[model samples]
Target: MSMINYKYSFTILLAGFFLISCNGKKTENTRENNAENQITISEGQFKENGMELGKPVVKPFTEEVSCKGYITAPVNARAKVTSLISGKITSLQIRPGQFVSKGNVICAITSTEFIDIQKDYAENSAKFVKIKADYDRLKSLREENIGAEKDFISIKSDYNAASASLNAARAKLNSIGLNPANIENGKIYNVYTVTAPISGYVTSISAVLGQYADMTTEIAEIVNVNQTQLTLSVFENDVYRLKPGQIVRFNVAGSTENLLAKLISIGKSINTESKTIDCIANMETSLNKPLINEGYVQANIITAQTELQALPNSAFVKSEGAFFVYILKEKKSGNYIFEKKEVHITKSNDEYSAVSESLPEQETLIKGGSTL
Candidate 1:
């Protein structure tokens, strides 16, 4: 009877243990299933959040900068006209604002010196003719053995000297702006006409219709407005950045009309007074307006050049005064992530900066914070 009691008690204990184990197992399974469901829902919510926020947007790269300059004539050279001889200005053929072609008569002068030149040429020419006749007569006599060799030689010598004197006198006349043919054409006494040395507009005329002028007096000033050039002064610091043949844009002072030009020269020496270096630009075309009144123009010279990536200032976010951009990065779980990237901007222009490193040239950058 004691053995039976023991067996029954053992059975009861075993049954109780089994029931507790099954119950614990069911609870554990239930908890695991509930946790898995919650995790799945959380993951779905995270993905949905990503979709609701929308995909990150990228922007095209651009730059920002500000520069200044002006416009001027491309080719400007001036020539001053002066009288070579003392005389009365018989006629002032050209006045200021007159367009004169090369060799066009500008003014006329009547002078005693011109009269002397013509008289010398005529006297020497007459002597030359007389000597030639004498020489011919002497040569004939020498061939006939009727003239002495010395006499013949003297006649030849006289003839050669007369010819040389005539040539010298004619040259002198030409040197003084007298034409040899004009002297022969009976125009020797005519007032000598001063011709234009270059093609351009007459800028200044000091000679009046009966004004007295001499070698020391300037009769007129001819400016080849076509040869007009521009002179610009740049700061010393910007001087080193200039080069010959760089394109420049120019505008008249207080005028919005602009013209294209190029750098002809850059001053090597610095000005002591202004502490600036002069830069010269040449225009490709001429300006028809009164150029003298074009006034002082501003110049913008490009000194330095470099190619670098640039972005808008808004693309960057400031943290502790340092700049950073939110770069789009892909996570290992196939999710897009925003990773902060630090960049160094070397030089800032009006709208952009010159960076030291090349950004993804072909790739799109994050447009702005709104895209995130």
Candidate 2:
């Protein structure tokens, strides 16, 4: 009877151990499943994390690439007035906002360097005359067989060298805004005259009258407002949606009406500070409103329009250059399960993005969360 009691107790202990092991395995499996594709958050925590639920909606969406920038002149439209020779400004009659025509005299620089250039050209001209006389006489003698070949060859070389020196001096004087012919004719130029290279308004003058200027100094800037373009600052996230020749609609401050433009170029590099790509657009026609240089502009690069599954910009989260969203799979006893699912953004603007994936049946996405 004691042995039977012992066997029965042993069997009971073994069965109890097996049942406990099974229960532990089940708990482990549950945790593994939950961790694989789920997040559990209590209602209090959910609200604290600023979680919001949303359902994906199908709608007729007009996709656009939204951006903002300023109206400014392109590089080709801006004329940077600089001096080839350093000198003190003897005369700067121009003022800011004054209009200037191409080749109009803007300033005169009293450069002693101008005098030196003139002197060099004069000396080169005199030397060239003497060398040419010798070369001509030597050539005549060579043809007549009246001189040694070596002597004529030497004179010819000297003549060629002198000619090159004279031409160089002439070019140098010309570059310094002096005419070699005038200098040779005994015209003494003490001041180097500077002129406007392009027709535009004098936006600024960096020099005061009598201030010394150099090659490095920007004497003035002229801008032709007619050549102004829409300089759009497209964010990096939306840069991929843009291309050259795309149409852009722009609006200025205090105006609801849009100005039309066509995109002409997209930037190759991104702005590190603003994380934006610089884009340029030209107007389809003359703008009705006055073009303000460096004026602020809000723009939309019109891409396409179609019915799409859409979500707010906040609904998408980016990771490793890919986009993702969270969906509420189940709710039980105040615990919520949010399954992270990858998503594709076909097109986006400031507030909304069209997603390629539609929501699963009956599943609502975590449209936004502070934890994200």
Candidate 3:
């Protein structure tokens, strides 16, 4: 009842465990096969023809191109005035940043030598007048047969010599920035009134009171600031694209708004260092007050303008070597659909340009497609 009965019970328990493990293994294998058979494949199709495809959308574009640059004044329009004769500056009536007109006196010189020259001229002129009067009277008497011909001849010779001396003295005064005729004709006697050479603003002044000024020395620089021209240096390639009379918009380097201007001239030579050509632009409005300094300016010059179908530059997509935009077309299911179309960029400005393709009818192009 003890050993044999215990052995029988242990065998029965071992058999029960083996049967349970076999059943668990069979159920796991069946479940694995069922999972593999559950997999399904569906055919991929394009939006237009039910084939695999990925394309961008396109729509119509109409925009204008605007170029911009800065303001500038021409250098040739400025003038540097110098003295015409060597003399000490006794007085200066004009200062820097002053406006002057033609014939306005800016400075004066006082010289004893000039005084002596004037004295000699006056004496010589008086002698010539008296000598001519005597000669005329003697000649008249001789012609009437009442005076000696020798006397008339001597008087005539004296008159000619006096006339030559007066003429020589007058030329000397004229060369020293004085009008000899004015002195002789009593319009002016001794003092010299130096006049301005041109109408402009005095941008600089070197002539000081009680200083010496010579003919070769510059006394002041007068600039016609009102008639200024902006000179911009653009690359040689950009220079070739610009033409005279092209409208340009430009602003100060740090400004958000731009000013209007026109292309006046383009340089024919290239700058060796910058590899750029000099461009001249005349401001449409007088830049009485410029935002930037002279000598250099940052600018964008307009080279050309044309009409073309174009959207915002961001709407274009680039893949491989082609560019495209996404256009939303209406579908028969009463839902919006997007299609991709290729485009060729002919020209572009900051905001718009010319394109090589037209947009589809009744379709709206997707903007900012590049972000997609």
Candidate 4:
């Protein structure tokens, strides 16, 4: 009876051990099924989560170089108004920011030298008339064989000398802004008018109403906004990529609007102090108002174009100094799994980025992977 009890107890223990082993196997299988690193979702769940898939595409990529610069008027567009003759500023007609047209009188000056020039012109004119009349009379006598050859020659020489003096005096009056015909009409005035050389806004005024102005003094400055240029300083490394007619996009400092410009010229040599070359560009569009000369600006020059394999910027996920994306894999009907992938990005813009590690073009990519 004891031996029978021992056999029954041994059987019970064996059965219990087998059951426990089966249970452990089931638990291990369950954990293996759920331990995948990939994420699996049904079609309905994907739509609910607002997930999307796309394929990599080939698109045109533009390479750009960044630069800093300022707005400046071209040399021909800027004028330094100066007096051609020394005089006292009797009347000042221009102030800073005033618009003036070409040939408009900017100031009036009075000087004793101006009066003396006019008087000399008038006296020379009278002397020339008398000498010419005497010359003509002597020539008539010589032709009729009634006057000596020596006398006629002497009179002709005097006439030529008088004519030269009169011409020189007239030119001097003209140089002082006096019309020679008006001066010859006996309109002698002490004040000489100084006119604007170009149509533009006056930027500076240095002549006072009662101050004396010399020929070398800068009376005022005029700048034509229409001829303004964008002067950019490009580093030596990127200067070789720039060329005339390239498109440029720039923004003024302290403004949000982007402006357009076209490259016009590039400097021949790099500056020794700044180690940069000058790039000149013209504005393609008119501003609402004239830009102040020497206003600071930031610019990007579109240098070259090529085709590249690009993806939307939303596809990138960055972590721990590495970038990643999600690629989709079909598991079964109505279900999909996404596997994380490592990629190297070459370049990026606001909307798209060019990546180096290329996948099959047919492979599906999960959009908005960074949010996962």
Candidate 5:
């Protein structure tokens, strides 16, 4: 009784295990199939959910070349405030992040050279006056045949030389922001004022109080925010595909919002260090926001436009490394039957994508609802 009963019980237990394993495999396969199968949504719910459908329309999409660079001001829009003369910085009227206008005094410096310039101008002015008087008298006498011709010529030469020296000294004073008219025989301009050359916000300050500065010393750097451009570096491989008037979309570092610009020029030479060509783009619009100078940005230069069959960005969803678009298969009773069809994306942009395979002519495609 023991051996026969035990054999029967073991066979029944083995049959039950096999039955449970087959059902579990079937359920798992069904779940996987459901993801790519037909989806049915009620018409009322679809409308409430703001789903839209239309035929695959032919729209323009651009093939883009990815790039990276910085936002920079144009050449004329940027200015370097420098010390035109050598002096120790006595005062600083402006600092970094300060806005200044053209001709505004940026700083005051005390320079012994300014005193020397003034002294030379004063001495030259006095000499010019005396020389001119002598030359005039000699010329008058020569016209009346009362002075020697050699004497008249010698005085004329002296007069011309004196005048030139005076003018040069005056120009030197003017270049250093001292008016010749404001100087007298002994009056000296101890403090020279440096003025801003352009209107812009100061980006950097290199000179501080008590610091010595010269013609090579840059006191500050200014950039006009209203006049800015994008300086992008595109690899030489993609350089030939670029041209003026192409659209450029960029995202500044630390931002995901898209900004737009237009390509204005391409650098003729490639960078030896990077093997990339410099591309200049003018900011077409900023939506009331101004671009910061030297802001790093990642950009896509839209190169070519082609009209192709495509759908809205929301209409396609990526799953398991493939893109699928929802197609309206049929409307039965009150249900909208949509099928998820894998699509071959030939080209794509931020707003649309072009599919290689043409969908059915009469069937409509969902343009908005992909998440459902």
Candidate 6:
């Protein structure tokens, strides 16, 4: 090869190397700038935009398991008022939603059976008195050796029978809500008073004035609101998170205030149909607002808690499928720069969220982060 041609080829190779080196340097600088990306805004602009900065707080972080249920009364605090005897309802003094006290007259019922029962009691009382007098006289005579033993024995048996008949008659009147002692010979009661068996608010009234009610008929239902309980349906997967005495926050449908309750009992078996366990909670305090039995409720059962670095819910910004928060990086003159740091949220409540990420503890995080 000629010397001039060789020199030219070598120079072309060196120029190619120089161009490759320059391109590589440019790519490295681009990557470095991208890695340190930040947003700079003047302090005046930050204030105009209502941006706020705060520090991460170490607060109690609670993990809650949500469930739905209803308000209910304990079995002992509720009653199904019924008539002991078949009768026509003469008067109903109470209505649904009315408060009633124990032993208070709830209604008046009239029945022919009431009169019959009183009459039988009166007649048996008179008969028993006469039998007792005769039996006593026979015993006296026999003691004086002037009366036959057979006569004494027979009088004794008749007296015993009469006494039993009177007792049975008295029990019948009592069962119908009529005191036998109050029933006289001519004063037979046709109307019997049905009294409230428990002190509570009437939830239902099945009997109306002039309506015939039998023993099987339910006249009314009473529920003691002070003993109201919250029953929650927890699935099997979350049942283990519940324990007696755990606090529960709940809200009834159409109610704005969150009510408080404490778990008292948990069912041992899961419901076959709903695949849930029954958890019963008593109201922490008597409800000032009226709550109906079987009213639907949305509940949050706080299962566990721990101290964690938490921030207000607004501090976390969501983009695409990832969550991020702004960390105050540097401030020069009147300008502030903030760098975005990705975070993982572990738990959250209405106000704050527990977060986990590789972040400096002393760094100031922007509050109301969504505004940015």
Ranking by TM-score: 6, 5, 4, 2, 1, 3
- Among the numbered candidates, top lDDT falls to 5
Give the per-residue lDDT of model 3 (tens digit) for 137-251: 9988988998888888899889989989999988888766667766666543344445677777787787677677667778887766667667776766556567889766666
Encode model 1's per-residue lDDT on 1-372: one tens digit a residue: 699999999999999999999999999999886544221123354455442222222333332111343333443346567666678998878877888888888788888877887988988887888899999998998889996899999889999899999999998887767777766666667566677877887878877788888878888877766666777777787766678887666666667775666778988898899887777777754567756523476645444455555665555556687666554443346444554556676766445544455554332233443333
Worst 10 residues of 2 by lDDT: 361-370
- Model 5 scores a TM of 0.79
Clashing pairs for predicted structure model 5, backbone only: none
lDDT order of candidates, top first: 5, 4, 6, 2, 1, 3
Judging by TM-score against the true structure, name the best candidate: 6
Which regions of candidate 2 deviate over 4 angstroms?
1-62, 254-257, 288-290, 305-372
The CA lDDT at 105 in model 6 is 92
How many clashes (backbone N, Cα, C below 3 Å) per candidate?
Answer: 21, 0, 19, 0, 0, 0
Off by over 4 Å in 4: 1-59, 242-246, 260-265, 268-270, 284-288, 309-343, 359-372
User: Per-residue lDDT tens digits of candidate 2, residues 1-372?
Assistant: 699999999999999999999999999999887687677788888877777887766666666888898989878889899888888988986898888898898899988887788888899999999999999998998889998999998999999999999999998987766667788898887778889989988888888887888888898999988888998998999988887888888888778776789999999999999999998899776765447678798888987767776777787888898888778878999988888778888867556778767657555554544374
Q: Which portions of model 5 miss their true places by more than 4 Å?
A: 1-41, 184-188, 268-273, 286-289, 317-326, 329-342, 360-372
All candidates: CA RMSD in angstroms? 13.4, 14.2, 14.7, 7.1, 9.1, 4.2
Each candidate's TM vs. the true structure?
A: 0.60, 0.62, 0.57, 0.74, 0.79, 0.79
TM-score of 3: 0.57
Task: Write one digit per residue (lDDT tens) for candidate 4, span 1-372.
Answer: 699999999999999999999999999988776555367778787777677788888777788999999999998899998887678988889888888999999999888887888999999998998999999999999889997899999999999999999999988977766787887788889778899999988988987788888789889999987778899999999988889999998998889788899999999989999999999999997788887778899999999888888778887889899888777766588887877777899878777788888765655555646556
